[model samples]
Target: MGGPAPPAGPGTAGLRAVRGKSIAVLGGGSLGLYLAGRLALAGHRVTVALRPGTPAPSGIVAEGDEQWSAAVEYADIGRLRGPYAQVIVAVKSHDLPPLLPALAALGDGATEYVFLQNGIPWWWRGIAGDGLPRARQVVGVVVQHSAERTAPGRIRVRRTAGDRYLCGRPDGSVDAALESLAADWRHAGIPAETTPALRRQVWTKLMGNATLNPLSAITGATVGELATEPATRAVLLAGMAEIARLAERDGAGVDNTPEQRVARSAEVGGVRTSMLQDRLAGRPLETEALLAAPIAIAEEYGEAVPVLRTLYGCLAFSSTSPERNPT
Candidate 1:
């Protein structure tokens, strides 16, 4: 959406997001903590919602010296109210039932939404099926370099590339407001940008997630372990090919080659896939979003995703009995 506009200046985005832009984060997971901490650190009035029956967050400050004790309040997403200028969704895909109605309750005709989730956006096509109010729905890709969840409310983000994110409309509505907000995200220690295209960005990241995340989870192996093993490397390459074909079908151009795609993952070292951590903790894997969705897409295109299909099926069964998986 490159349009004619004045070049970005110091005060251009300064007035947009810095003042009175209240943000509500949905889930109380590590992602919710990370975003809330940064936003709170940036002086935005922020609130993080925790689901019922979940323990209250214990710490006053995040793992880093980032202090969010004062501005960051805890609320329930399903019953949140307006006065919030924007809503940042950092919940698991399956955990939306409680929040949809609450967000609808806000009744603010112009509340911006930023969805922070992994894997494909195919589910959104279904959620937005009936033309759900399209006022402002921005897609984002976050390259979070740090990962640590020591306890329920405790998290450690060792490094962040500023706001290290990208945001824009999926249907090509490029304007100054979104760009200004993106700039604010950058200033909040979370490098961000506004892009005209989101479909490509989503899948490009999914290439590493679909392969690295699951394999690492199953093997209890780090990215380095998975990338180096001959058999694991072969599996990762095959998965990448399928993801590339799927992206092409959906009109997202990305390097789908095994060698190139594998490198993207090999760089992550011994990081534990979120799913692996969930399995170890006896929490439900985000199986439907991360694994099932891609397999469904492969079937839609009559494409064979043998490795992915098998991996998904195995994980599917294992979800019923978390301890059943040998790893």
Candidate 2:
């Protein structure tokens, strides 16, 4: 309703070009695929760089006249190079380091990165060790598309680019380029907005992710089933409160009450959080960045997060065998 809040501390990058631009998505996940489809459909030439381990379904590659099928490649950045205006890092946050050297190697001086992963931006700067040089060139994106690999390359994607998506600069101002990109992406889904207060967006998503993801995984339940009873919602609220506390102390706000977010979770019925899906499939969860990281930060800020600690323990204990916890 209002203009985005001003940049909090020393990090924020505005979009450079509001006119036509070529972009490459760095991963081949459902997010990348959906983005490719939407961008291409909107008349923007889009390329997705795929690594050997990245999953791709047998979905037909229908782009261009030749219609060459798309599959994963084990090529390095120099080999599978991108000379585009923007390079999007769609990989998991933990898996970011492997590609950073390549992106840094590009060193075009004009290429910007759009971070499509969840969690805090400050955490990202720490992980990559490049700080604001990398941070300022970043466009923080919030995505609400439910995705997973159905097979190798063929992802069974929903028609929406994503249900909720946004891109914002570090200082919280909208560049014409990001606004245009959002408009182009709308052909794929309903993108929420662009703002400078991306911290709020990221934290809102983290609250939902940190709470519901672990709960669902521990109990093997869907979102609706979890919220069906008051007890589960209470546990979730405790987790949310911990995040809210840390976010405020960290100098950011979700800018909404806990009750408002809790209600939104209820609306996404019959869906299991990503952690539940990962645990069931025996894949590693984003535990450090998603659950433990926020709780740990709460401690650093001289606050208590007992409920989060307990929930984190419960999730860690239940989602895996005792052997996994080094006990």
Candidate 3:
């Protein structure tokens, strides 16, 4: 309805100044805007980085399950300068490569880098090379916020789940920056929390992505549709089972069973997966990170993922089909 109140001496109205930190959210998409707005509401000095040629809005607007607006600083990622206390990398997994140079230039070794991308991170298990600045503290966040960006600085959240954000370190250790950020989000009325089992959460979220993302892109179906339709639901369950086995073998056991995961997907209603959105917009699908990477890992460990392989093949074929409609 209304925007956040003015900061009281560079921090939350009644809180100490030190509670607020300088934060940069690097991405202009739904999750990025939502994080920027909510963090600003929590009295942090928030800046949002937009792509070149994208207009920077004066502030962020969030509607639907959460309703609030907050003024935030904006800059082009290419030109963004940072001595920021924390930098939240909210870009999609496929979009990270070109941004690496810019991200590597941000801040110093003490700056905390919180990566909030979907699927597994490149740095996990050295599955991919790391080009991030050396000595910088990096952490992962598994987000459960269901949101869509309607415009450059506007978002609509369809929060149907209990957890909104779960932040943690990869080594099952606690870090003050992540804990404080999660607390700030909670103070802003977001359901944020910290976890020691971040990798397990990563795999838990991956179970859904590995199953629903590619299927949604290929079938042009919503999350609920894929979870409820008999034909797609069977494939979804089988894929989840495969991912679960893979995760277990990799030492990051997922907490939910296939049935439970499907029930959660059904609860998200009609929201489309990000991969489906990318396909509809004729952008390259995140098949490499979300699907193919996991498949590769499964192969190395001798895990069977036939269902996931089939889904990946269908999605790859559909995304590149000469006759497929872009929209």
- By TM-score, the best candidate is 3
lDDT of 2 by residue, 1-327 (tens): 222322111111231223545767776655666555444444455566666555444432432211223332333334555556677777766677566656754435566677787565443334346522355566778776555544444444332222567677766667776675555455423344676677777887887777888888777778877776699999888788888888887788775567766777677667667677667767677777787788778767888888778878887777567343311
Error of 3 at 233 (Å): 0.8
RMSD of each: 4.8, 7.7, 5.0
Residues 67-167, model 3: lDDT tens digits = 77889999877777878878889888888878766665777777788888888786676323455644226777888768888776898877553545777
- Candidate 1, residue 7: the lDDT equals 25
Per-residue lDDT of candidate 1, residues 180-226 (tens digit): 66756666655566667666767777777788877766777877778
Prediction-by-prediction clash tally: 8, 13, 0
| Candidate 1 segments whose C-alpha is farther than 4 A from its true place | 1-18, 58-60, 64-71, 126-135, 138-144, 160-163, 325-327
What TM-score would each prediction reach against the true structure?
Answer: 0.84, 0.77, 0.89
The whole-model lDDT of each prediction reads 0.66, 0.62, 0.78
Report the poorest 10 consecutive residues by lDDT, candidate 2: 7-16
Candidate scoring better on TM-score of 1 and 3: 3
Q: Which ranges of candidate 3 are over 4 A from the true structure?
A: 1-19, 127-131, 134-136
